[model samples]
Target: MALYRIADINVEYEPRFDMLRERSKKYLIGPSDKVNFKISIKNDDPSKPGDNNSGLSDAECEYIAVGSSFYKGLISFNGLLLHASAVAYENEAYLFSAPCGTGKSTHTSIWQKHFGKDKAVIINDDKPAIRLVNGIPYVYGTPFSGQFDISENISVKLKAITFLHRSDINTIKPMDGSKAIYSFLNQTIKPSEPELKLKAYKTLDTILNSVPVFEMGCNMDEEAAEVAYKAMKEGICNED
Candidate 1:
């Protein structure tokens, strides 16, 4: 059993593979007698889908299984996993979310290039956890970060969340709370249990209320990041 402190929650779980152990090495903590939750991954875990069907090795399957369990339990702690690339700049986190293969990571890379490493950093390239601490939403890094293993064991106050759409021209606009909530729901893992689902919704509502949301039509260009940063950070929208 190993203890990890993720999103300010102490989680205990036994990893059956070396890949999981290595991946989570940075988040490891000393032995803890008390834990917020414990995760046990089984051979038939739902996260695994089917044998070879997911095209994932046993180690990869265990990694996702642990993450799935942790995320489900995270809802209880006012947290949820967002499928996005979280970038931190000037002490604030800006999350760029979109469906897989939609260039969320590419967008953040543009931020890195535009701002330089001294100014911008990718806190989590994918699957960052968001939690409300003292009624303020914050984004945290976790080991479940996708392919690139780009993640940091850090937390930053969430400044804004932007949904990206591919387009030839760069454009951005704020999204209404209702629409933002719906968009966010699609990016997060909604629980199957009714009670847990309600909790997830409540947590999402709290986050959306506190943080601004935007939708951007952008291409793979530096201007896209510049426009998004201006709107989300400085609130310098064309209309506003």
Candidate 2:
């Protein structure tokens, strides 16, 4: 068993997870920073296994165990794990959210190209931990960052959460109230268990109320990125 830090929690995993262990090295924290997630999953008996997919495979079960441990630890502290692409610009986190393969990552990469080195940084490429601390929203880098697996153990003020969709034209519009709520909820986890469901609702409500949200219609091009970033940034800052 080894203790690894992930999303601000020190999780202990018994029998070890090779992928997770390697992924969490950057996030390892001291004992003082521990939040104690006791995670474990039994491996299938290789000798007795007829087929790996006879039921839920060992890998699938391990995935569930890891997620459950993270969420439980997160919920206790009012944190939320969101499926979005997050970038940090000028000390603020700008998140791009969309259904799978809507170019959320591509858009963020364009922003990096537009801003050049160090001007725009990818905070979490996939799963970012959003939490409200002291009534201010912050975006945290987590080890669970999807296929890209890019993350940093850092936190930044959440500037905006934008729902992205492909459009022939490039435009960005701020959304509020119901629209914002709906957009964010779609990119966030919806726990089926009642206790976790209620916690998620509360955390989501806080996110919607605290930050500016937007729906962006954009193409996979530099012009689209430039237009979207300028419009969203200036619009939020109320600058001419």
Candidate 3:
């Protein structure tokens, strides 16, 4: 078994699976002071690019198994892996989540453009981790970033969560508590256990209470970002 540092936590891989090394290369550490996650995959064959294997069919299943385990472990420790695009702007993390092909990435790109190419950056395009650190939620970029492979081994203070949907014109509105809770449960790495479910929702409730959530309806354009950001900033700074 080899220990790997992933998502700002120590992970020990059982059976010494090396295929995931590429994704975790930057996280390889000299020695782990602790183990936050564990995975055993010697029996599974991971896919490699251009390799004459059964494509990603087998790899995809393995990924799901590993991912599920990691998610459960994370949630057990007040952390959550959200299915969203996390971007850092003005030293705060903003998340955008939506259904497949709903242009989640496109929306954040506009944010990057609005904040200036150098000022704003996508920390993780998918599967970023949100963990409660000393009562404050922080978002971390993980290795499981989606195909575009856009991610960095970094963490940022989370400011808000935004649910994106396609609409004719750009609009942003504060989400209701019930709607915010459900939307978070639907979009995050959900845990099936009864106790875990309760803890997840409680943590979410606290987060939504402090950090404003918004449902952003907009088209695929730069103005969408401007409108959304303006609404969110004003709302957050002015909230009681």
The lDDT per prediction is: 0.90, 0.75, 0.75
- Give a tens-digit lDDT track for model 1, residues 1-240: 889988889999888899889878889999987799998878677548446576788888888778888899999999989999999999999999999999999999999999997789999999999999998999999989988789999999999999988998888899877888888889999899998988898888888889889998889989988999999998876433
What's the TM-score of each model vs. the native? 0.95, 0.84, 0.86
Q: Give the residue spans of candidate 1 off by over 4 A.
A: 44-47, 52-54
Question: After TM-score superposition, what is the CA distance of residue 99 in candidate 3 from its true location, in Å?
Answer: 1.2
Residue runs of model 2 more than 4 Å from their true location after superposition? 32-34, 44-65, 236-240
Between the candidate structures 1 and 2, which one is better when assessed by TM-score? Answer: 1
Which scores better on lDDT, 1 or 2?
1
Better candidate by TM-score, 2 or 3: 3
* Best model number under TM-score: 1
Best-fitting candidate, scored by lDDT:
1
- For each candidate in turn, give its C-alpha RMSD to the true structure in angstroms: 1.5, 4.1, 4.2
lDDT of 2: 0.75
Residue 28 lDDT, candidate 1, scale 0-100: 94
lDDT of 2 by residue, 106-125 (tens): 99999888887488888899
